[model samples]
Each structure stands twice: as structure tokens, then as C-alpha cells.
Target chain A: MSYFVSPIAYIVLLVFTVLSGVFFFIYLEGFAQVQFDTRAQLFQQSFSLTEFVLQPYFGTISVLLLLIIPMLTMRLLSEEKKQHTSELLFTSPITVINIVLGKYLAALALFILMLLFSSIFVIVLYLKGNPDPGVILSGFMGLFLIGASFLAVGLFASSLSQNQIVSAVISFGLLLLFWIIGASSDAETSVVGYLSIINHLDNFIKGVVEVKDLVYYISFIFIGLFLTHIVLDSQRWR
Target chain B: MIKVQNLTKKYGNIVAIDNISFQVNKGEILGFLGPNGAGKTTTMRMITGYMPASEGRVEVSGFDIADDPIAAKNEIGYLPENPPLYDDMKVTDFLDFVAGIKGVQEGRAAKIEDSMNKCGISDVKGRLIGNLSKGYRQRIGIAQAILNDPSVLVLDEPTIGLDPKQIIEIRELIKQLGSERTIILSTHILPEVMMTCSKVVIINKGRIVLETTLGELNEKLDGDNEIHLKLEKYSSDIKAKLSALQSVQNVNDLGSGEFIIKSRQRNNIGDEIARVVIDNNWGLKEIRPKLNTLEDVFLNVISSELKQ
Candidate 1:
């Protein structure tokens, strides 16, 4: 169903190439200041693609994703309701869950397309410099988890209201809360600190595959999607 | 077949439909007659499972609406107050999408084609629904409702917002559709009820105030049998003359030498009056009987209700 629109595919490819080239130019310009004395140290502390590409990659993606997911999901149910076409679909033999998931998967497929395009950034760093693939792969894994979680939350917010503006505000508000909680909390008992999507994302950027952190990101995605399903189910009652 | 029992719906503090019970037999076209906001649409919505009733049991094709909505819904095709169309989509695509969701299988193309032809929407099938005229839009809406070939069809104001020509065409189309499908058509148009429906269910104040068959409706109005007589001769004696006849009930000599005679039973009262006029050799200027019609009954019922 989603294959007919190539804007999603085109945007991912264009952004990935443009952003990676801009970052590459910045790295190349910074390299001029390094002297021969740094060559040995550079070999020892090689610019890990995992650190150079994935950390900055996810940072850029997390913020960009917050804006884009809501844009894509805003029209999901709202347009259906506004056009009065929900009457046809709701009264049909299909279940509400199938309708929700069908659109959800379509959006996820687009997000995956964007992820595939971003993989070029890893390729650019690997060819130009000595970068480890393991860390880079884990970083991409983290990006996938964070993007999925954001999309789930955006989908839930989109399901809440028929006005796209309202859905956007709710999604932005939830994303902002997730962002600030870990940053503001004290370290010792900061489950909020761990809940910080940014903090969970940091472990993957550093090339360490922490199983517990992986579990946390996966659980976050699952919970957001589960809550979205619950919201849709409850809306029928109200 | 459909049965609605003890149906009641309330919006916040206001009651929309209260304790309404009615049943529709197989292969019947039942007209729901009510003035605006008299709960006709609300009851139709409840029966179609578009909204939940506060208290009721609705059964469609042997399945309870609340207990098995899927089964009940499967039996019915409903066109709501609005058409519920996706205006952006082309007519064909919209119908195809509905057919897909409705789970009407591989024969959907044939069904869509037949419905489009039947509804007179075949010419505009390729155009976007947003671009179609209001008449065509209504036809497309009806087309979608019957796309599944459901056993029961519910149409809420199918002829609303149309020109006279469109109204007649749509009415004729509905009459044709009603032949194969049991239909519940709700409208305030009295003539529409009289012409299209086999039975009338008149609702007032959220209750079924009257239920009348077409044969009974004619009997209530008693057909046209009143005779009017205009005389040149003064006739205070004519009142007793008419009352004594077996065919006449009572007679009133209207001022200006005209008299109106109402009969107790319908018969050839015009002939009886003409024979009496000939026997007396009176100069009768004119004689005519008033034709009883459905409008009289409607007016009588409303005026009586107002007086009460």
C-alpha cells in the first residue's frame, strides 16, 4: 500500500547523501591541523565510525525523527474521520486492530527505508577511515530502536485527536518529556536517567552491546505501541 | 428480517429515542415517518449499530446487534444521514475500497458494475466523487450501501437535498431496490411514504404514534363520497328530506342557496340527491362530491393532536 509514494524513499536518499557529505567536508577540514606526531596516536585512537558516525547520526536522527514521525502519522486516522470514511471502514468486516496495524506498518516501512538510506553514512566513514563495523552496526541498531519508539508515540498521539495540530503538539510534548527526564534527574536512583532515550542510545554509540540496554529500548517500543492500541480500543467506547 | 425491542437512547440528559419497539418482516419496505428531531435517525442508527443504544435489543437476520454485531452488520447495508463518502477518491476506487473492506470477494467488479448501472452512476464512475453533482453523489451513496447485496438496507433521507427530477428518479430506483431487499426508509415526506412504502410507521415525540397499512389508510380517509348541491329554491325542508333517505346521514343547507350532505356510509349519494331534485323538479345549479385524500387524514391527526 505504501509503495506507491516514492517521496519517502527519495527524501531518505537525498538527506543521507547531503548530510554525510557536509559532515565529511567538516572532518576533512579539521584533519589539516593534525601534525605527524598525531599519526601514531591517530592509528591508536582511530576515529571509530561507531563514535564518529553513529553518535552524531543518532543525535541528528532523534531530533529530526521527532518532527517527521508526527507529520507522517498525523493524517492516519484524522483524515479518515474527517472525510467520514470511518463509517465505511468501521462498519465493514475488518477489525479496528487490523486498520491500526495496517497503517502503522506502512509508516514503519517508510522509517525502515530512511534507516536503509542512512546506512550510507557508515559506508562513507568505513571507506575513508579505519572504522569498526561491529560498533557501527550496533549504533544503527540503536537508531532503529529510537526511531521505532518515536514513531509509536507519534502514532499514539495521532490516534488521540482528529486535528493534526493537536496531534503534533501532543507528540512533541511527549517526546520533550522523554528527552528532559533523564537529563534533569540525579544519577544514583535515576531510573528516569536510564529512561532517558538519549542515555539508552549512548551505550550503543560507544560500541558496547549492553543486553540490558537493548532490552530497555525494545521494551520502550513495545510499550508505546501497546498503549497506542489501548488508546484506539478505548476510543470506540467513548 | 429485523426486530427492534425496547430501544432507548439518551444524549447526556436529553432522551433521543425512548422505548421504541418495531419489527420489519422479510421483503418489506417500511417507511419511518416523523418530523425533524423526532428520533427517526437516532433509531435507525441504533438499529444499524452505528451507535449503542442505552437500552434495547436489536436483532438482524437472527443475530443480536450487541451480541454479534459482525453477524448483524453483515446482514445490513446502511446509508447514514450523510453519504460517508471519500470525496477525494474516484467513484470506482471508493466502491472498490468499500467492497474490499466489506469482504465481498472476487465478484466485486460485477457487483460494482451492476450497482453503478442500477443507481444511474455508471457514466460518472471514473470521475472523483468531489466533482460529482449532488444527485450523482446520492446515487453513488446508495450504490455503496447495496454493494454487498445485503439482505436488509437502511436509508436515512435518501431523497433529501435533490431536485424534483432527481427525487422521482431516486424514488423509482429505491422502489426497484426494495423488491430484492427489505428496506427501512426514513423520511418526513408524506407523499413519499404513501407512494414508496408498503407500511407506514409514524413517530411523534419519540414514540410510534401510528402504524397504518395502505389499505387501512384509504379506509381511514373513507374515500370520496360527499355530495355538494347548489339550489335556486330556498330549502330549509331539504335538511329533513336528506336525513330521511337511507343513503344520506345528515345535510346542512349552506348559505347562498348551497347545501353540503355528509353520508353515514359511502354509496351513490350523488345519484340519490339528483333523483330527489328531479322528483321535486327543483332547478339544481351544480352537484359534486368532495374526494377524500391522504392529506385530510394527516391534517386531521395533527390538528387533533394540537387541540389535545
Candidate 2:
């Protein structure tokens, strides 16, 4: 509720919703135009609703999340530090792990709320076209995993500093680092390529739920939360 | 109920608080008095386990803070210099959150109400904390601090930045709360200690300068009796005559028939001074013993330490 109360959260939500909606509509219109111009060719080719809509929708949502998740999480711990309210929590009976988990869960809850709103685009596609519900579910799952991973990293960034802008910048830099690492990897099948979060999400986008992809995202989330706990605990010593 | 043993805190090489130690018995209010940068806040933070000390131990209700932080923290309620408040949260909602986090599972509503009423913030329960005044916010801070009814309360400058009336009200509230739990309140204000605290520990330059009760402080100040006399008629010879007396060690004229006569020992020399005034016909209007204030003690201790 505290995060939702901030006007920045609403602004971020609105911008994300509008941008994704506009891009989804443009993609749908372009696809419709292509179908009209080459209806015979389109029918001959293997045209998939998942490829036409769900893929683009989930891909666009990931990019939007890269920008929006940091804003959602920057104030999680930074505001408490800035206002000197962290002292209350530090002195309370709660441990640093509890504080870190509590704030991370709150940010995750906000991310889930945003995901629910973005599902409107998927619902629209489901009604307008015969998209596979299974594919759509997998895509939604991938989007959620990526968003949660971003949120965890952003939460760790928030714990790093008392300045919200610094936290946001750090989170953005980290997410962008993970997003672009696979592109620079020499081999696509190499271990280095797996460092990129976007690489792992490819399987989920194609409606394939590989155990390796699940482990990648789950590890990312765990590492982010663990680092956050360490940072929060270190503050007590200083 | 609260015992701090040789609590020393250092930030890098800078000693924020030197080897300082004090104890607050159950139901006692210990005034943590100091000037700015005198390590009062650091000491309180160490006591509350908000931060760890470099080389000492703090025990609250027989639980060592460093070894058993959760158990010790559970026994304490702390209010930092600035109230730890969520400006976006309403008073009731904020207190409810605090109550929940503090693990007050049963009778939570009653506990919140009791704290709000005790801090005189029941009227602002429905208002946003951001919309409230500083005084009200401070009351809300106190309200949250007392929510769990901890055995010890640590307040860092509770009356700071408050108006006189608000300061008095908060002081009264602190006094009322101190009746049930041990409290350590830090403040740079002198008379606040004299008025509210039962005992005071004055710290200067990261060290404890004095730890004495208010009654003992008054008695100590009164022991060095100095008579202040104001007379209508001025006489140059009155000083010599007063100094010539057996009890008078020194007599200094403070201009316009006002004289300060220092006694050789702790004795009431008002009658002796009156006799001199009558004999010399100096028209004595006012004559009284000047009691040393907390300001005097504070300055004396601080300055003496600086000289050393």
C-alpha cells in the first residue's frame, strides 16, 4: 500500500499500460495488413497465433518491465533509510532477512498487479483469434518470472543506497547488463550465453517450460534476494 | 532494568562515544544530558541495539543486546531523534502496522488505543501522519514506541524542536510512562532534565562527566552558599566591612549596591549580611542564596574537562 500510495507508481503503471497497449495494437494491425495483402501465401504458411500475438506481447512486456520494475522497487528500502525509519526496523524484534523479504514481497505484489492489468492484451487476443490457451499461459508465466527476477534485482539495488535515484540507476544498469550479456557471448550454446536472463526466457516464450530455464530464473531471484539480505545485515555493522 | 557496561562506539577512527557506562533501574527515568556532538544519540542507539558498539556490552532486562538482540530488542521501545514515521500512512493504520510487526497478536486493537490515548494522539488517529503537525507526529512516534509495552524505552531527544507547551506535554507523557518502565531520554536541554528526569548522566567529549540525581545535584549546588544582596543605598565601605566578617571569604560589588558575598563554608549567612546592612544603613531590599543551576554544572564540567 505504501508503494501504491506514491504517485510515481501510478505514473509508471499508466505509462507501461499505454505503451504496451499501443505497441500490441500496432503489431496486430500490421499482421492484419500482411494477411490481407498475402492471404493465399499466409494460409499456405504455418501462421501461429502464439507467434503473432503472445510472443510479441510477452517480449514487449519484458522491455516495459526493464523500465518499470526499478521505479516500483527503488523506494522499497531507500525511503526507509532516507526517512531514518530503518532505525525502527533495525531495533525491532525482526531480523534483516525478514525486512528484506517483506519489502521484496511487496514489490513483487505490485509487479503482479501490473501483470494482471497487462493481461488485458492477452485476453483481447484470445477473444479475437484462436490462440492456444496453453501457449498463452506459458508466455504469461515467462513474463512473470522475468518481472520477478527484475524486481528482486531492483530490490537489492534499493538496499544498496539511501538515494532512490541511485537505486533506480543501479537496478537499470544490472538488468540491462543481464539483458545484453548473451548477445556478446561467443557461442549461443555456451555457459556464458546462459548468463543472459533474456536467453533463458526464449524457451518460455516458445511455449516450452524447460527445467533449465526455470532454474535460471529461480536462481536469479534467489541470488538477488540473498544479496539484499547481506546488504541489509551489513548496515548494522556500519 | 537497563544496564550499559563500558559501551564504546567508534566510527572508523573517530570515537563517537568513549568508555561510557550507566544503569537505569526499573521505573527510573535517566536523563541523558549533553551538548551537541556529545555522543548522547550514539549511546542511546547502542542501548537500543540500533547499531552495535565497538567495544562494550548492553543488557536490557538481563538479556545482552549483542548476543541476544531479538530478545533484548523485544524488551525495548526506541524513538530516534527524528520520528520513524511513514508520512503516507494514517495514524491508526501506522500504529496497527507497528503493532502487527511488534508481534502483538492478541488484544492488538486495545493496545493501539491505549498507546494512542496515553500519548494524547487519539484525536489524530484518523488523520494522515504527513498532514499532522510536528508535535502530533512526535506524539505518534511516542505512541508507536509504547505500543508493545516494552520494559525499557529509549527516546533520543523526545522534546527537540517542539514548542514550550508541546515540550511540557511530551515531558509529562514521558514522566507518566516512566512510572511503569525504565527510560533513558537524551536531550541537550538543561531544565528539561531538572524538570522531568529523576537522575541525570551528563556526557561530554564522549565520556560520562557526572551521574547524579536531581536532588543530589540541587544539594551539591546549594552546598557552596553564595549570598546575593541588593541594596538601595550604595556604600564603598560596605564591601570591606562585609569581607571583614568571620564567615565572609570574599565580597565583590556587582554595581548599584548589588553584592555577592562568598562564604568560608556552607552556612546560611543571610542574617549576618542583614546585620551588616542594618548597621551600615545600606537599605537592603533583597538578599538570597544563589543556587547553582544545571547550566552551571554542565558548563563547569565541560569547561573543566576542556581545560584538562
Write down the C-alpha DockQ for each prediction.
0.33, 0.73
lDDT, model 2, position B58: 93
For candidate 2, give the docking quality class from DockQ: medium
Candidate 2 backbone collisions, by pair: none
Classified by CAPRI criteria, candidate 1 counts as acceptable
For candidate 1 chain B, the 10 contiguous residues with the lowest summed lDDT are B290-299
Worst ten in a row by lDDT for model 1 chain A: A1-10
Q: Candidate 1, residues B1-308: lDDT per residue as tens digits? A: 88989998877778778788888887678999877888998788788876778898999889898888788888889887778887767899889877877889978899999989888889999998988887888888889999999989999999987789878988898888788778899986878987888887877668777788877886776655678888777757766787788878777778776888888786767887889887886778999876566667766765666687
Clashing pairs in 1: none
Candidate-wise lDDT, in order: 0.77, 0.87
RMSD of 2: 2.0
Off by over 4 Å in 2: A39-43, A185-187, B278-285
Model 1, chain A: how large is the TM-score? 0.82
| Candidate 2 lDDT over residue span B1-308, tens digit each | 99888989888999989998888999899999888889888888888898899998999999999999999999999999999999888899999888877889999999999998888889889888889998898888888899999999999888876788878888998898889899999988888888889999989989999999988888866747898999998878888889999999999899998998899987788898899889878887999888887788889988998999
lDDT of candidate model 1 versus the reference: 0.77
